[model samples]
Target: MIGETLSEDVLSQLKTILPKYGLEDTELKIIQSYRDSSQLNQQSGFSFQNEAGSKIQEEKIHLLENELRILKDKDHLAQSVAKEINVLFPSVDSFSLGDFLVQNVQDFSSSKEVTVLVKWKHQVGSVERKRLELF
Candidate 1:
């Protein structure tokens, strides 16, 4: 059952059980939201004709809009990071890029320089690590 507040005990139980089903926190949140919204819709059937129901509908719309904005911002950020990574390693193919893992980021605020530690696996099964600087 969904409650007004998601308790620590519920979260702990979810954390333990979800992994066995190959579901992560984000996926669980989406599923929970969908189920909650479905329940709300059922409970409010035809009630939208009233003022109170209209206010609740407006609030839900606002909440959904905010979530959409956050998702868009995250998408833009991911694209920007991918562009930076491509610029940092032009020779690295798309498939090889998958093998690259970011180890650390060092930023020099005064100089406007950023250093990233990247570890990559080569086609020959050897691992290579590099420190790249961007200005």
Candidate 2:
């Protein structure tokens, strides 16, 4: 498992097991980081379904952000734990899922009102369409 990377779905489910290993605080921190990252991501052009998904996204971003911060610290134990986290959630280092939130952006010239268009892409038959939009 250390040589091969973990998939997103697997990482998501495996995250639950970290707590059993007494890494709950570390995991929570990572979730908080992802939440913070998600807030910035919300500024991007995309939409979320219901408040629950939005809330969950925020929490995940926050957790990821906190974990990154803690990992950056010089604590030896924290560093070791961070390595374990990397092994579990391989996607975290690959791309910021938060970036998916802000793939597109539009601005109004007169009002100076920044409209954030959030859309979720879905597959319809043979084509993919953005089904949800939010500003």
Candidate 3:
């Protein structure tokens, strides 16, 4: 489901969930708040009656879980174009632009394997260097 878009139905449904912990809002107002945007983007925001806030929180958790799963899968493999680029590249000085790669499939042993041709640009002080790694 990578890159999958949330359906409008899911969005609308998410827009309607009340904070389970806002139990102090009196059961009546809290219940009514469901399917109601009357409380969002207002002073009564979150911690109480915000709808979008809850959905966003849930979506963030979902994305993090997916990322962890992808990382685990990567660990189970030997070679991959998937690098830990997001882990902050160790640049020497002020700026570093790196880990650019073109994806391709290479046929090996009658099977196709994913290959990457990576180009990295590193800059230290006024000196800039470019390196390529193919695997």
Best by TM-score: 1
lDDT of each: 0.54, 0.47, 0.45
- Worst lDDT run of 10 residues, candidate 2, spans 126-135
- Per residue, candidate 1 scores C-alpha lDDT tens digits across 21-117 of 8775545541244355556557545232578888999999999999899767766765777687677655444421121333444653233232333
Q: Any idea what lDDT model 3 has?
A: 0.45
Between candidates 2 and 3, name the one with more favorable TM-score.
Answer: 3
TM-score, cand. 3: 0.27
Better structure of 2 and 3 per lDDT: 2
Question: Which candidate, 1 or 2, has the higher lDDT?
Answer: 1
Q: What is candidate 2's lDDT per residue for 48-98, written digit by digit as tens?
A: 367898899999999999988765562555456456545653333321112
Which tens-of-lDDT digit does each residue in 57-92 have in candidate 3? 999999999988876775555233234432333442
List the candidate 2 regions with Cα displacement exceeding 4 Å: 1-48, 75-135
Ranked by lDDT from best down, the candidates are: 1, 2, 3
In candidate 3, stretches whose alpha carbon ends up further than 4 angstroms from where it belongs are 1-49, 79-135
